[model samples]
Target: MRVVKRINALVLTGLALWLIGTSIAGAAEVNVYSARHYPSDQAIYDQFSKDTGIKVNVVEGDVNGLSQRLQREGTASPADLFITVDAANLQRVKAKDLTQPIESATVNEVVPANLRDADNHWTTISLRARVIAYAIAKVKPDEIKAYEDLADAKWKGKVLARTSNHPYNVGLIASLIAANGPEKTEDWAKAVTGNMARKPQGGDVDQLAALAVGEGAVALTNTYYYARLKGSDKAEDRAIADKVGLIFPNQDGRGVHVNVSGVALTKGSPNKANAIKFIDYLLSPTAQEAMATKGTSEFPVRAGVPQPAGLPALSTLKVDPLPLTKLGELQADAVKLADRAGWR
Candidate 1:
């Protein structure tokens, strides 16, 4: 009986030690659901782990798919953070109540107030400008100056754009609606649709390609896409970039329209503290430089980080001051207006 009692106590002690060890291992990791598809992001994660002794595990998917997954998982979700592009996408997730407000002073200080959520539910990690990429040889820069100019009768059949359903376009039109009421923005959309060089088709890169080949005189594209082409290793991509010149539209007015890729804390974040630490690390100058200057080619939200080469200075262009949260609020309206305007 004495021998049996001693064995039982030893067994309990071993089991308790194992359980504690397992919990410690699990507590040292953070799970992330990320929609930003940049390949260089892995290195950034690796660095975070090295610096802080916290492991980063990422699940990648499109914005909508991930948001749906979070909703399905509810409070049992393993995701501590959700990262995606575009204000509308972030807002969509927020609207679904999949994210909770991130109350971090470091995040607020590193990222500009305008680039963060008003309620701190989400914040921009990087910025991309939506600008007019014109065929240098075909269109003189002065002739096409503002986003509003695309709707002019003289530029009929000379505009190139992606489908209206694209989030980038939705954000653009939403900003326009914020700047000018829905009615006038709708009118602008209708006239711009009337000026299509061809039925809106392909992604921004394709639009840039079409412009390079003279399919259209001006193409609406993100600055990073142009930078990718300019900095591409392939000679053909370089040639395509060479054929195009960028115009930061509305510089004389509300400034160029800029969009963001952002991060938010999951409503049911299993590892909230670690997730907040990761968010702070991402906003750090070192991480910002890695993301912005590496393959991602995006402008860092933290002011002092250097932008990728060949992209124009962020300070030079006048940025549209409309709160990005408004982009999400007006997104549905923007899409409806585009459809009514025939911007297929």
Candidate 2:
């Protein structure tokens, strides 16, 4: 009877050891649900893993789809971090209670306060300016100096942009509302809608292409799109880049409206410690430099990183200081204003 009891105890001990081993292995990796599909992102992840010996398992999808998956998984979700572009999407995830505040002194010290969430629920890792793209042959560089300039009578039927509901447009209008009162912004939106070269259609590149072919005088697009075209292997893309000139809008006022590619800690973070370490690693100089010069072509959130060739240094550009958190808060209002203004 004593022998039998000893054997049972040994079996239970082995089972406990196996469970402990499984947990340790799992804790050595982080599960990332990332909406950023850039091929350069994988290279960054690989570098992180090489440096820290912690595996980065990424599940790539669009923001809305990934957000839905998080909701469906609930607390049982294994996602350690959620990485996506646009503060508005981060705000949506926070509103759904899918994210928790990121508690890392390294992250706080590295990223600017305006570029991070007010409540620490998210932080931007890279930035891209929403600038005016114009045809040098059509619009003089000084003609459209600010976003407000687009609504002027002279620009009527000459502005090209994507649909108003796009997150990029939403973030842009939200920044406008933050700068100007809602009433004035709405009026501006209405006038800008009337100024559209055609009904809002296609992505930023398409808008730029339209401007390139003389379909419009100017278009609103993120800066990186132009960089991508300039660096593209295809002759046609480089041709579009050659024909288009960019105006960093509002440099004399609140500065150009810039948006971010940001990240957040999932509320259901299974490997919280490892996740935090990974977040810290992303903000490091090596990672920042990699992101900037890699296929992404975005400015690093960290100061002093080198800009891509032919692009102005980040320090030279006057970026809007409005806390990006406001982008999320005012997103709904921005959407409503766009709808009322016929920016469909």
Best by TM-score: 1
Instruction: State how far residue 26 of model 2 sits from its true place (Å).
Output: 4.1
Q: How much is the lDDT of residue 179 in candidate 1?
A: 92
Each model's C-alpha lDDT? 0.90, 0.92
Cα lDDT of model 1 by residue, 27-68, tens digit: 698999999877799999999999999999999998889999
lDDT of 2 by residue, 135-233 (tens): 988988988899999999998889999999999999999999999989999999999999988999999999989988999899999988898898888
Model 2 TM-score relative to the real fold: 0.93
Give the runs in model 2 whose Cα sits over 4 Å from its true position: 1-27
Which consecutive 10 residues in model 1 have the weakest lDDT in total? 308-317
- Candidate 1 has which clashing residue pairs, if any? 255-318
TM-scores vs. true structure, each candidate = 0.94, 0.93
